[model samples]
Target chain A: MENENMNKITINIGPVHPSTHGVLKFVVEIDQDTIKKVEPEIGFVHRGVEKMAEMKYFNSFMPIADKLDYISALNWEVLYATTIENALGITVPPRAVYIRTLMCEMQRMMSHLLFLAHVGEDLGNTTLFMWGFRERELLMDLTEEVSGGRLAPMYVSIGGLYYDLPEGFSEKLLSTLSVIESKVKNEYRAMSYENGLFKMRTVGVGIISREQILKYGITGPNIRASGIKRDLRKDEPYLAYDKIDFDVVTEKAGDAYARFMVRVNEILESIRMIRQVIKDMPTGDVKVKVPWIFKIPPKYTFVRQETPRGEAAMYLVTNDDQKPYRLKIRAPSFYTLQAVKELFVGSKVADLVAILGSLDPVPGEIDR
Target chain B: MESSDTIKGRFPTLLSDVPSTNKNETVILLNDKSKLKTVVGEIKNHFDILFMLMVVDKPPKVFEMNYVFTNYSKNDILTLRVNIDRNKPSVDSISNLLGSADWEEREVYDMFGISFKGHKDLRRILLPEDWPGRPLRKDFQVTDEVRNWTGLDLKF
Candidate 1:
């Protein structure tokens, strides 16, 4: 028998709100407080970065890349830089490679920290939010020490990085890492992870299957959480990842808790990687000079890199012009969000924010 | 690379019809736009995911559509390049074939104004519905009306 309360109704959640994160609108059709269909409307923040790419010169577009995924700005900067470098057939030196790698891993850690913080707040745990940001600020300080910019740092150039590390940067970084490692392992574990109520909120909820990962073209930590054992850093071996040794973490459950576990483990793994990069650091020139008005000869150049969110890639088609003929940015979140209907359909209305946080999608790239 | 050979071997009959160009061996040029579904359906098993859908405006006449397909197990990339006439450009949507193609085809339609005939919800996914002109198109010249008109009449 259908109860009086079991009628179907629609509820809209913000093109502007906290949980949806940066100008995303979600329409959830509910049947007795259970999600029947979830439709996420994107592009509230779309500035047409692709169209802007067609107008800007090869070198001029590097700073704009930082805007796409400001959470992990360095990764996008590296990706955009690598695209032009590949098109121009320029190889970055070993030192530059290691520097890019170190900075990228740090950005990954920063991204995950914010994810943990936001997800904690979503769960109504304000203490975890404060703790997450507390640890994240240390890394932020280190990045600012080098680049002098917080959040969206325009540190990477076409050939390599904008500048090399300072004299005591490595020493300061090692100290900062040690502090982060201890806090993450101890405080974070106690606050949210090991807490029974938190686990109950997350465990076995918002399950995205392995088949769905491939179907929706979900990548990065999202796919890894589903136990696919695929990471672009290991698979393609871009930057200095091939040289460094680290494990690609995975979980069989494909639940919200599994995704959370993957990000936490990945943070530790990134710390380990940073240590390796610092130790095996080669001394050489940080950047090679590429002209500002350079042109990539007529060709279709595609570059894919693993950002904190997912497999963010850029497809550039050049035709002997100062600007790209046509540029297409394949934001992984765009694909990741496509599976929202599948993820939300059967879940309780209260668990929506928890499920969303587990995915760790930033809308900057999605709306770019 | 052996991966290229493996690709050819994986789908022998299809490759024989559509020749791969020199820009990259993975890219296969499909001359017939109508046969997109049959070809995708046949090769769908080999390609685990539709990695990306890239539609380029080739200035004077053609709209070159590149469908990048990737296999997770084999770690291989195969691009199916299909070209359509610029005037009244339309093609069969492969959203039913690959779930990943759902949003991509919509995005292509929104930006390039290339209609995917069979897409279920074909509304503008990015720009305001009332916004004039396809912005990604090469001939997208900003008119006074388009530039100045505030997006207040977004009822559509």
Candidate 2:
């Protein structure tokens, strides 16, 4: 008789759903249109990069790291390179730092642009999806100009970049960024932010409080959207972030709408940082010469970087070997997905997609 | 500095006296695994966030578990390290205190076969169910079947 009261129907959402954004599957238990529990069953796309990192040389692992987060590949590359450089006590040139910083900001913008488009599409407002990608192409052009690749570009190296910035690259970037800035201001604001349908679908749904955020280890824009001023770039500045001035955007509502707004504002902030980086751009050698056989001393170091998604950390252990003894990737999405289990409880089934989109779990990084 | 002094003053028995290797970060290695929950609970009360949890395999019957906690207010990171027996690696789960540990503890169990005693659910995360052995272990050898599946003829 007691078991009859606990009759919750299980509904499998993904593993191949369009809204999942990747190969993420969720076994959501619902009781008549209301979600009782959501169990995210990931690992469908686990490539075991950590095990593979153990076999590759210190510098050879950069490409592997690039595959961790494809949307912001440069950031992952920079994170791995800096971790190795820090372990070896290699001082990156100021010019190189500025260049890396510029690229990172651009990458952040690129990621947030995608997030905006994705969330917009998820909420049935296709205007943002169309306009955001149109603006993102301009950023991609600058990316190709600097890194020589469109996506999955492993630009940052151990000592510095693969090469120095191209001549007149700053001018081109400035021009492109200004164009992007205009579109974001006029077009995106008029289309998505003010759209009535977009507001209704997102507002007051999938709400996450500050306590829930801390309990689940959710970070980046998601936590910031919950009204917590916890951006690693602000809390613990890295890669020229200390030199720049930008506000850590936050939204107190902690709902799907707030998360969307936070990323939208973050895109604007990234543009500001990119503009500052170009203005204060130092002049020097981008790439420094290092020994062919790069061997780090026996030590363990953990380095964290504020990626577009959240705080991504690399824990490296080297036993005086050419390759790392162990490499542990602390991806933000891993915990975010964990929090999804609780995010769906007591909400209408319609809110599941909005919550999933708002959380923004990159399955590649989460499953890595 | 205040947090470091406070931890040192409080857990004099559990924390090692050795100075931290990293300048700004504080690293403490706990000698006992039984008191992990107690010490971690105290740390959570001290810090605002649990930054990361990682397991390191120190071969020949020893595994080291590292829990990194951060005080966001002061921008300080405190890493707590605990060593357990490699033969049967298990520690008290901290997921109850820090909700973030739910997935991470499962991940450690999946890769290294190091289980968390009090965890509600412990299952293979990054690999398929019924997969032969823990792939992250030092003694884990690559099977020919896996190599064939990966399209590589190399064997370990």
Candidate 3:
């Protein structure tokens, strides 16, 4: 009896659980119900992408990049191609930049919608889950129409896109945006944002302070939710983000609710950006002529893109050849997953999945 | 907060001349690996965030480790490059200074086999601990079993 009272129970959560979002396992050390310590056991989906990138050609790595975060595959595609473009000093046309920006914002909205569905299920609310996916299908349709693939869109290429925006893309996109904006504001908002049960579960369940965000290197919506006014679009201004006008969504709470609210508002902001892109889209070639055998000089460069989850950066070092000497992908989920140790401590076992879902980590990127 | 150019100017002896890039990013090369921990500490005085740490295997024998830091207040980026001997690669750990470095350093240790002297719990984060040689190293070769299966002795 004495030994039982003294001993803390160790529970294994998963490399396959539904709430984990992906193959992420955690060994939770607990005493009765309170979580004492959580040691995450990741690397389940490590496909050796970095090692594989070394063997592939500089431009041939786009397909591999798409696998990193399939939720926002276009973002990864654009990021990889842009890094290569930066290294080789290839300039993309203004029309191409606007189209790329449009695709990126659309990816952001899709990712957030999926996250909303994930958060809903994690909290045992199937209504929000259903509503999220229902609204998400519209955006997914638009994505397929514009990018040529629904999930893994390998549309973005070095110097520009795989092809120009098809005729009537802007018109179709504008109508879809209005419908999404209304659904999100009227129907979807009530299910998660305003519902009593949803608020009770998320409002203050997993509070991530600003200090925790910086110390743990958490970025994207997570950092913005914690009241940090930092967005790569506004700060770094890659692509057509500099020309567009939209507010950076932020909340002061730094809790689960705040994270949810931030992403929701960001969907609205993305809608605004997409509208601006369609309105101001210039006329020109979508892609420039890049060499078939792309060779980079001896140099090192880092290119950053603000993804749905956070900032995705690529650090490339070339050795005066067609192949990259070294390429390191800095995925946002990698840092966010590490911060979970600090976030999970002192939280109840019941709230574990809720907290984990709110962070919105994709194992593909985390283990890459 | 001091700008990246100003900070790079202060330590001419410790750093090489700043390289010019099309993006106008300030890149400072550090020839000395021993002074890395102190240099990072100095950078922290101005830039509070260590944006990223990337290790590149330079083909014949050098290993270049880049520590990217950014001053959030000023939007200035400072990249510190440290060249380490491939045969004996080690650097003082800055995990004590920044909590973010704990996992980043572990990852560096795991992927490149470059030990961080003061990292509290240095273990493999991505690959299995028992996995053969550093996979990210340019000279890493496939095991005999893998080579026999593929009919090629793959070497990165």
Candidate 4:
């Protein structure tokens, strides 16, 4: 009778659990110790972001964009502002582009740091989490030093950034990057992939095929892990990415461990990219001259760039007004969340948390 | 009908079919309902990525749905738009072809009150289940009573 009851046990693991990292829930149907089916229950924290865009002016919507993926706030702001600028046929100054690229790369590093910390904590390695957060705090300080706010730095304006880098900004950022680079490497070697138990838990688990990745529209590090050599920075070349030099990391395994390793490698690459930007830092005007209340032309445009998780896309439709007629944010986590059902179908219940942590999804991006 | 012009030079159907209204992007208009699925399949076979699907509300009771496909190999984007009547807005769900369309179609259904036939899991995604009207529709009204967030008679 106990065995019979175990066959039909269904567990709902939060729109509010600590392991979720944000507002997201998974209804897992299990048989014995193995997961039979995983139903993703989302929209718990939906603020109607798309509908809100329709009411606010195009420029005013920047603050709202900051709320989507609050962890990587600059990445969200830059992508949306660049989309609007692209639609308006405006040219952002070279300095502005460089600054945007610097911030984007920094944001990528910060986001990966958070991912590392949380994934460590999820796997019961609390020491790695502390180390990860310590480095991430240094990055956050750099971000706040430049942009003013610690979390939602509404620094990137529509045409360009709100202001230029402050005094001693380069020195401060360089030191932080150096410290994080060495510290992250040390932590990875001591507590992460180099450790046997960590490898045992992550390797050959929650495997996804390359064909399935393509079928599901997966991008960013997730796609890269499946041996795909596509990076928006390298291919599309937005916001001074063309000028910067960095390698696109890949792992052929296409497993949870591969995803983790790919992200680990990406942090090093971001450090390299940021160092290049700082070394060749250009001096010019940061903000483009534009009216306070600018009206967009009657046209529709779709813009996308590589976010840390995947491809973050913004769709903008304007109707000769200061406000956008319609706006849609194609968040990467939203797409990645769907793949969980397929991933957890055959995995054991104990490995479910590991798989979820490996995905590194920001539920704000998913639920927004 | 195999002239030298026809043999040596076939006009680029993909380029010629693109509507002129698209300034920065290419838009394809599909009129035949029966060809919708096949056209999407063909585009998918060629492009290998379908990025987004959205419903556009055209004035005077006409709805236009767009399927955006981006070809990573060719570095080109093609958008297919299908028009339907607002009174009976329905379209065949392409979730079978493009995996990402699953939730996007559900979102369209929730917002625009359009019906996607053959969708496996059709339900309100962003809005509450008991929500009365489709908020994205032009006809949907938000009364003062409904807009009040903190009151005894608040209706969400």
Candidate 5:
């Protein structure tokens, strides 16, 4: 009888594959159940965001930044606006900084919560998806209450925020935080991390070493999971992250389970950060006194900050014009995605979904 | 610290003569081909992270490529720039040292038509497979193909 091991099969998990998520395609070389190699074929969701920004006015590009990381829309806008502000030498008001920081933490919570729900669904725990979305909806409601949009909250403007938090926003935020914290704790304990099946599926699976992570320029929880104490918020504090007290969560094991645990704990820390921002927020003008349209000086500037996913960086070049000469985004997902090459080299085909879920990549961010 | 200062002070001497600035960051201009790789290697050894790679098109036949590197441990940024003739613009690829340079180098190749020697995969990323000449060059004209895709009947 001929040996079955003689044959090698190649699978194209596509630009449209549900498991692959978004427009990313993976061409996997497999032998039976073991994956020999995984080649990531990107540029599917490339909408020419950088090219479009070159044509649009500097301030008008905030809405485009909102679309890049649509899952964490407010953070994306804040990063772009802050980069412009940094280039132009403007300082945002104290109250605006606190509000921006609060909303950023809220967005961080929602992003992590969505990741939990999606990871649960990927692992066949459907109830956790509902629980995750249910909690995420409360936070989305708070976003709408403050920014007037549920998803694409283009609230952070250059040098400040677009507007102040609405009346009773603080009370609503506090109540929502309490409910989310309890639900998250219960669901995480019952369905994720602590669950035997989750541990068995994720622990020791998709393990990436600290050396490999640093070599690949991986950041955020993925790097932290490898025992690297490099959270940009704590290391390079921006906005009100410096004022608000919080812990930088890290896990020594650098596995899928470690990445998941880091995010789960980060949600609780975000709640703490939000509570502090609300309590310590000072009274001042929310918007800076600047003209609606302004020309930036001729210079190049680079700015970066911690987003829910990782370090989102923006590089801007201005030619003393209303429109920017060039805009380049160093999205965190793009860097984290590099680890997939190292993660899936020797893993089973079935474990690909779990590994990808732990990465929690936003393709819009990757392509942009 | 003195060694770092010597290297920092000698940055301009290593490159083709252009005014150098060492404010919060060090910016060196290079126009010589022989010094490009060695200068880049020196910068990379000093700064671990290659932060940004950018190409700018100046009208009528000149393109400038800039490589920015930052040393997180030392809290300093170093920028090295090279000017290339538009007709035959080509430079050495640094992707072997900085893995992050892979995509950015390809992007520079795609937009400005400046080739990076030894690039493993030099295919167009953001543009379509059969797209024409580079788009960012001042003299390069936008084709009617893009206009047709926009669903507008306006003449190009």
Candidate 6:
């Protein structure tokens, strides 16, 4: 054992590696390029958002909530809003729910596009990254047209949305959606899916077994990729998801390629949901009247919503105070991060980036 | 959604009377924190995973630790809440039972200053290893030590 220890070496991969997506570090023990152990070192971006919630008012924390999953801001915003709404026993207007649903799907498209871009770049495909961002820009423009914020919209409020859909927003969105849909089906396939080199890097790179997934409580696309067929939206419908119809994309392989395919198919699914939401959205007040200063009675409310990365939950503890007594933001990435060791161990160093990118964990959410 | 009564009936000995909270969420406060291992171990048949371990600081009393478990096949969620005395501020680690409890327990230790009896690696997860005080505690004061934290002291 002592002699074996002398041959193994440990290397540190960034709290700031370009391909890490955010500030994530990995301490790896390697024996001739084969990983013996991978200890994921996170919390570089821990902003104490949960502690911040205790200081801020109930309604004032939306801005902080928006920053949790920076990639899919709307989903975090919606989850936070829904937790408060559920605690207060307030039902949002039908129109607002539809709008929230539509915006969330759009954010899903944005997030998944970024995932593709990041993963593509990781596998040495700069064009795929550019292509991913190119389509994502159209979404940023559309969301900006309505919400006026590119990354953190701050559009979602306690009762409903801050603003109604902008003029000609539907027409522009429909056109953009079709363009993305076609590009995703054709261009994305031509660039990565059909490319032999792409398959070589991803097809069997990092595989998460069903047992590892359940053991780590992995949710969302990461879980779906492992063939469990579990999605919070379909299992327990929240927001406008009950009315909208879509399939929960799943892949049996549970490898890096399957994870990629799952998110790619989810983009198409989101496009379908967006179209349904637009056609069926009822016209009504965007937001309900909420008092400037109101307190939610003492109660514990837990609201889990399906974000692009996975199932994100926000648990709110209120004590008849304007601010939450304790606010726990459960980012999907946090649980997914827990399984990094189980997933990465026994894999090659080259496939490390491939696996991490496939899971798509945002440190903002993980550290929060 | 099942109420606290239905869940309590499953584990009669150690489960105390706990109030029901929200739809699809049944909160059960355990009578003994030590029984947590057995309770979770027994219920592992129905629940597939321990989704999250949430710690709520209820000062002047104790820390209310909630273990959220989910049964994906049945589409059910159960929150097993245990009260740890503020003085002792410790509980049994369930990481061996459900693999996800490892980091969450470490997180609780990091934020709430709650120790796990048999946690294999119960170090600060989200904060620096030498982070001065538990920030999530209600009475935790931000002293000059926390104020002067440059993070440069972080060895890694």
> Highest TM-score, which number?
6
lDDT per residue as tens, model 4, B5-117:
22113323322244433333567667665567766766665666677776667667888787877645444566777888898888888888888888888889988988888
Per-candidate fnat, comma-separated = 0.76, 0.72, 0.57, 0.43, 0.15, 0.89
Question: Per-residue lDDT of A93-206 in model 2, one digit per residue for the tens?
Answer: 999999999989899899888888888778777888888788888889888887788888778988998888888988888888888888888888787777787788889988
lDDT (C-alpha) at residue A107 in model 1: 97
How close is every model to the real structure, measured as TM-score?
Answer: 0.95, 0.96, 0.95, 0.93, 0.92, 0.96
After superposition, the stretches of candidate 5 with alpha carbons farther than 4 Å from their true spots are A1-6, A18-20, B1-12, B15-24, B71-74, B138-144, B147-156
* Residue clash pairs of candidate 5: none
Interface C-alpha RMSD, model 3: 1.6
Q: Residue by residue across B1-156, what tens digits does model 1's lDDT show? A: 355455456556555434432233377676678888877886676777888999999778999998987766665677888889999899999998889999898888899899998889887888888788899898997667866768785778
Better of 3 and 5 by DockQ: 3
Candidate 6, RMSD to the unseen true structure: 2.2
* Candidate 4 C-alpha lDDT tens digits along A1-368: 88777567898888786374787788999887888898888887777788778778787888989989988899999999888888788899989989899999999998988888888888898987888889889988888899889889998998899999999999989888888888778867778989999999899998887666766777788878878888888877788888878998999998888999999999999999999998888898998877778888888788889998887887777889888877878888887877887999989887887888888888788778
Q: lDDT for every model?
A: 0.86, 0.85, 0.85, 0.81, 0.79, 0.88
Instruction: Give TM-score values for chain A, per-prediction.
Output: 0.97, 0.96, 0.97, 0.97, 0.97, 0.98
Regarding lDDT, does 3 or 5 come out ahead? 3
Candidate 2, residues B1-156, lDDT tens digits: the string is 577668767889888854555546888888878998888877877787787887889999889888988755677888888889998888899888898888888889999988898899889887877677888888887778665454344768
Clashing pairs in 3: none
RMSD of 2: 2.8
lDDT of residue A55 for candidate 4: 77
Question: Higher-TM-score candidate among 3 and 4?
Answer: 3
Off by over 4 Å in 3: A1-7, A18-20, B5-12, B22-24, B142-156
Compared to the true structure, candidate 5 yields what TM-score? 0.92
Clash-forming residue pairs, model 4: A14-A25
Q: Which digits, one per residue and each the tens of the lDDT, describe model 5 over residues B1-156?
A: 332454546665656433332234566677675567677667666766666677777666777787877644454566677888877888888777777777778777877777888789887765666666676665665457754554345888
Q: Of the candidates shown, which would achieve the greatest lDDT relative to the real structure? A: 6
B1-156: candidate 6 lDDT, tens digit per residue: 444455577788778656667667677778788888888886676688888888988888899898888866766678888888998898899999888999989988999899998999989999988777889999987777777788674777
Ten residues in sequence with the least summed lDDT for candidate 3 chain A: A15-24
Question: Each model's DockQ?
Answer: 0.62, 0.67, 0.57, 0.46, 0.32, 0.81
